[model samples]
Every structure is written in structure tokens, then in C-alpha cells.
Target: MERKLFLKNGLAALGLAAIAPLANACKKDTSGSDTTDTSGTTTTGGNSSTTCTVSPTETEGPFPTKTPGSLVRSNIVGDRTGVAFTIKIYIKNKNSSCAALSGALVDIWHCDKDGYYSEYGGTSMQTVDYTSNHFLRGRQVTDSNGLVTFTSIFPGWYTSRATHIHVHVYNSSGTSLLVTQIAFPEGSSSAVTLVNTTGSSYGYTKGMSGYTYNASDNVFSDDTAALETAVVSGSLSGGYTLTHTINVSA
Candidate 1:
């Protein structure tokens, strides 16, 4: 099946639910070694040390620009405001024994503190107008280590979806490879809660209350544990840094 079609059907198979608190508490430990299973699927995190498997394919949401080449850069925060955040992603090719894939274009975009995307006008829930705004949207080419980093603010929560970021990876020649979203773990380990609740001017309007958890999001329900990013917080006054390794086919 086509990638987009597969993700659409996958979303349908996992029925959507009303926004609610997560039932399972997120674990604090986010470190683990990689090891390959008998099925050739590499698993990361938790107690297991296994070979890394291909990152799960996900839907390219409606908001992605029809032409994504124009938005290439290291910094994506155009003119937004919120707690400072740094995101680092490592790109590896599972088809080549989990080798690092350099020079790959990694595109990332997310909602602002008020849960509104850039370059698109405000939605019914978001009242601010941003028809020409382009915050939180940019692309970075992976370095020799297959690493791409972005400096921005921690994303805010919306109605049905959990706190997340959308990512799309393309080869040097611009062939789309992977389309996926990174989810923040729920509960005390949640970077979303730490930044929003304690700070007086962090700019996260919703905080954690009334927000959908990773366990409740249809797109992540299938494997919330595997997809959750490892988050490290400095101080509410400072900001947070998130890191995740993305494995994909060459």
C-alpha cells in the first residue's frame, strides 16, 4: 500500500477516543542499548539491547506545505515565543545494518505554545492569525553523524492530539523516505508539564490539563512506549532538550 494510505488505514484501525489523562504512567528511564531480534527488527530503549528497526511510518498531516523544499534551514522558530527547546534527531539506515545516513534532509514542524501551526491561518480553537507566519517549520540536512538539530520551544497540546512534532525525512536527491511524528511521554516525565505549570510566563496556554496523552492519541496508541522521545529538562526558567534516534530504510 502507498505510505499515506497505509497510515490512514492504520489510524482508522485504532479507534479514536476522547481526550483524557493517561492511564499508564510514563517511565523515567529513557536510556537503553540497541539489539536485533530474531525477526530482524531492531528495538531500542527499555531493558532490551537490540538492533534498531525501521522507524514506523506515519501520516503527513494536512498542514505540510505542498512544496517543502523552500523551508530548509537549521532554526525553525521564525517569530514565535515560549520556553526554549532543543531537538536532536539521529538518522540511521536499517537497510544497511543501521548505518548512519548523512546528507539526508530532515523536515520538522509543530504547533506553537497556543497550539497553532505556522504558515496556516488560525484554526477555530486557535484565534491568532498566522496566514503568513512560518514559525516551528524548517529543515536541516544531516551531518556526517546523521544528526540534525533544531532550536525551538516545546510544542503545546491541541484538542485530540498529544504533545508532538511532525517529521519527514528525504534523501539528498529529495526522495521522501520517512514520515513520522515524535510523542512526548505522559505523567511526571512529561516535558510539557514541567515547563508549563511551574513557569509564570512560559506561554503554554493549556499546560497538561485537558490535554490528550500519548496513550490516548490514535496515531501513537499502537506503540506509545517505543515512539516516546527521551526528554531532559534543565529548569523551567531555562528550557528543555529532547533527543530521539530515527531508524529508516536506505
Candidate 2:
């Protein structure tokens, strides 16, 4: 686990889609407003917030079978070794124009600072450290507008590609209708350098450009300059923000 030497060596290579509208309701208030007068005083009131209500919609597959998972590593909660960062995935069901999708599940999983996966019930990438169970994974449902958010740390950098997160969007019926992964821009030198510094020490491979970002992954057929990057915020101690939107309904 040496420092400078780890960056100079080490290399490894390998590797490897929506819904419908429910219902819409429109209420027209043609009647005039009612006013009350008392002692030369008048008062009027109405609904302050607009509400969108829809009828029951059909359920689909591949959704979570049990409770949701967690993406943040519990052990590294306060670790300020420059290896910590936050990842926030924004979820929305654009297909539901009539009403916002509520209770729509979103499951996300990624590697840890050491490039390891929890595997849930299986094993891949690295061994399944029981302690890491559900450490870097989580499941959340969209709110009234089909929106959900998860607070996790930035993923570690592996060989041959930029930092990315694997996302799964499922309906209430546990059917996984959409499977996709989003990546950050390869231009963040500071973020890339941090990955290289932390991962290199473990004898892991280094990024071709000394940083991690998109624009290099062959899997992202739609990988464009704009789509490759995401918005990240946070401090080196707590973590950073990772925000990106994917247009799946289109």
C-alpha cells in the first residue's frame, strides 16, 4: 500500500431501457368567488397549492423485493482522507404527464473507495465483505412528481473507464423496465487526481489521463460532451454532490 510507487504501476482490463401515461384531471371554476363582509370588512380565500390527482395506474416488474438499500459506506462516514465524495441521482418519471409518480422505486449500486461491490446476494468485482452489505447501494421511490434522491459517496476509479454509477428504475410491481448507467465528465482534473491518488495506493490501475470522467467508455453509445458530465458539490470531509438527468422516456 505504498504511495508514489502505486501510481507508477498496475493495470487490468475487462468488460461489458419505459412506461405510459395514467390519467389527468382538469377542474374549471366558472362560478364567481364568494365574499363575506362584516362591519365594512371583506375577506376571501382559496386553495393555496395546486393539486394533481390521477386514477390508479398499472404496475410493472424488476422492482426491489424487500426494503431499500444504502449507498454510503458506514465505516468511512468521517474519513477525510480525500477519498470521500457524495453522489446524488435525480429520478423522474417523465412518461406520467397526468400525475407525478409516487412510490416508484429506484435502486443504485457502485464500487467503494477500494473498488468493491456489496453483491447483495452474489459476489462480483471484489469479495463480499459482510460489513459492506448494502454499504454502497440503496433503493428509493419517487415522490408525487416521480422524483427521488439518494446521498452517497463518489465511486472509485477503475481501469479503462471514467467514474460512473449503475442505476435501475422499477415500477411498483418489481419489474425493472429501465437499466442504465450515468457518468461524470472526464474533465474534472481535481476529482480524477483524487481517485488516482487513493486507488493507486492499493495497486489499482490508473486512468489513462490521470483523471476519471466519461468520453472514454464504449458502452455509452450516446456519450456526448454534455451528457458525459454531471454536477458535483460537497466538501473533502463530508462528500460532494453528483447530479445528472437522463431522458429515458424520449
Please write out the lDDT profile of model 2 over residues 1-250, one tens digit for every residue. Answer: 1011111012222321000111121121222132423442212221211222211111111112234444322232232133455554444444554344566567766655544445332223223343324555667666665555665555764433345666677677767556555555332234443344444543333333333223333333232324424555443444455655433331
Model 1, span 29-97: residue lDDT tens: 223233434553223322111357877777766467545688887787788888888888888888888
TM-score, predicted candidate 1 vs. hidden true structure: 0.78
The best candidate in terms of TM-score:
1
Candidate 2 least-lDDT 10 residues: 1-10
Alpha-carbon TM-score of each model against the true structure: 0.78, 0.54
lDDT value for model 1 = 0.66
